[model samples]
Target: MTLYHFGNCVALVYVPYYLAYKHSGLSEYGAFWKCVQAGMIYMFTQLIKMMVLATFFPDNVEEFGSYLIGDFFKYTVDIADLVGLHFVLDGIPGKGHSKVLTAGIGWATAEVILSRALLLWVGARGAEFDWIYIQKCLESNILLVQHIATATLIWLRSRHNLNNNLKTVVTILLVLSCYKSLLFESLIHILKLGTWLGLVVKGAFTLAYGLFSLSIYAGMAELMGIY
Candidate 1:
């Protein structure tokens, strides 16, 4: 679990660095600060959520009224935080802005809610949810779907010749999403490896996945005319 958390943090930090380097030539300090800002936002929102969850729910077990309230509170707070960040940092369009940013946030939120609901439904069957197993196999599939959706959106945006910065932002998001998927897959596979041979196989899988993600990102960047 510690490894998983550390890997996620590393990937999140690296993503903005990569984007800044490839597109804007921002210094490491600039990229790092941006990542820090985003990290703070994420952590603050999650901390508030944890406090509320602890105070109100106190237990993982779900009662009808409590469960609904918890879910509603969690969803509302998360959405509000995300939208507030988006508006404050990115700003609403006057007349010529790609709606892709809004769409991306909406899609990501929907995906998270759907995934959690699916897990909850499965858990209600009295079966334990195997996070490692699900991350190994299912998470990649979900990420691939997201990438395809994002790529299609980028293509549509290009057809209209929207701002290059908008397309760059979308490509960066796609890369980050793919990187996260690969990182989760790596962590899960590493946890599952049993012997030297299994370790070798897991390492190979991680490398392949990483390379594939990089290729996807490079392609997306090229398509967005970032490089």
Candidate 2:
């Protein structure tokens, strides 16, 4: 039954992605190759981010201020993800919507494979069942929402026709999206929240961010007259 368990976990992890690609008109756009390209860029960007973190933010930090400094620099490195997303957006050949969808899905999928798949493969298939694997699957879904919203915000930020005020709002939201996990980590540490509570907070924040991004997108289109 371990295999069956594994299958269920896999389905929970991947089915949303498949439905998103199929139902969001990415299938009609034939964006598979573009998604692949974006995934490749994601991998490369992560590799560079890791290298930078390792080289600059070595783990010997002991002082509280050092920890703060280290974390600050590390978060700065995460901004590279936006640079990578921009590359993915510019590199893909399609309209804005297709490019955003392809880049976001591809980036999120690559993240799941690289970060979570092996843990599930080993843990979910083990004889002892763990709710952690299921939790991980739910986290994967959250990541999808966050990535897609961030992608839309980034695309919106790129539009020169968007007024400075809207662009500034998008930029602030984009930064918040990018630093989401760090903010959550800080909150969890400060409040000493349990794992389940932390997950609940993350889910709520992601939902709010997604809705806010959609609202901004609608406002942007209405104002600029183009996506």
Candidate 3:
């Protein structure tokens, strides 16, 4: 197997154990299990969405550059996926935001493995040394971090009082999550610049996204008193 496949291969095993360890000692193990369930649900939701849309829309890989049409589906899938996490977390009981963390871990861990890793292994086999893959990995990590924060923020949404400010904040976060998801999945189409230039552009976007994610995560952290 190629190095890309190997990395994804190792991750398939490593990520589960790693996330399990991270989920350990912090919350009920059941929360992690629920997270897994939610992840499965989210995956199926996307698959169904794709299956239905395939009747009308072009295959995303082939027509990803058709910004207007492609993005509608992208936004639909991403929003549904992220918002579905909100309902998933809300279904679970117990407070203190550990459940939120568990849910995020579950969601991120599942996506990184099932979607990112597997897709890269299958489609990017020959391009083991490609800069795009590195960019893809970076975007995945950023989104993973954002997913954790999204869970916490969504969890926070209900716990907080009914106020305009809180509503606005939650709205901002939800929008941010959807926005990031679209960009990460589709930005490659826009990165027509050569390798080095693309990497530079990707790097800049990733850095900005990381900082934005950190600020949101920090806000959630403060709410949880992690600081």
Which numbered prediction scores highest in TM-score against the true structure?
2
Off by over 4 Å in 3: 1-5, 8-30, 55-66, 123-128, 160-162, 181-227
Candidate 1: segments with Cα more than 4 A from true spot: 1-30, 65-74, 87-227
Model 3 lDDT, residue 170, Cα: 68
Candidates by TM-score, descending order: 2, 3, 1
Clashes of each: 0, 0, 0
lDDT pick, better of 2 and 3:
2
Q: Write the per-residue lDDT of candidate 3 for residues 1-227, one digit (tens) a residue.
A: 46755576456434554765465544445565776786787677668767766765665644766666576565655667666787778766665456666677767777777756675766557644454655566556555656666776676566654356766866786676666546644565575556556555555665665465456556656767755
Taking all chains together, the TM-score of candidate 3 against the true structure is 0.66
Instruction: Encode model 1's per-residue lDDT on 1-227: one tens digit a residue.
Output: 54454344334423433442445333322333443343354445556766766776546536636654544444444443344344323432311112332333333333344444454334423334343433433343333334234533444334445457656665565444434434444555668754444434544554554455445445655766654
lDDT of each: 0.43, 0.86, 0.62
Task: Please give the range of 10 consecutive residues that has the lowest summed lDDT in model 1.
Answer: 92-101
Candidate 3 displacement at residue 118 in angstroms:
2.6
Lowest summed lDDT across 10 adjacent residues in model 3 is found at 20-29
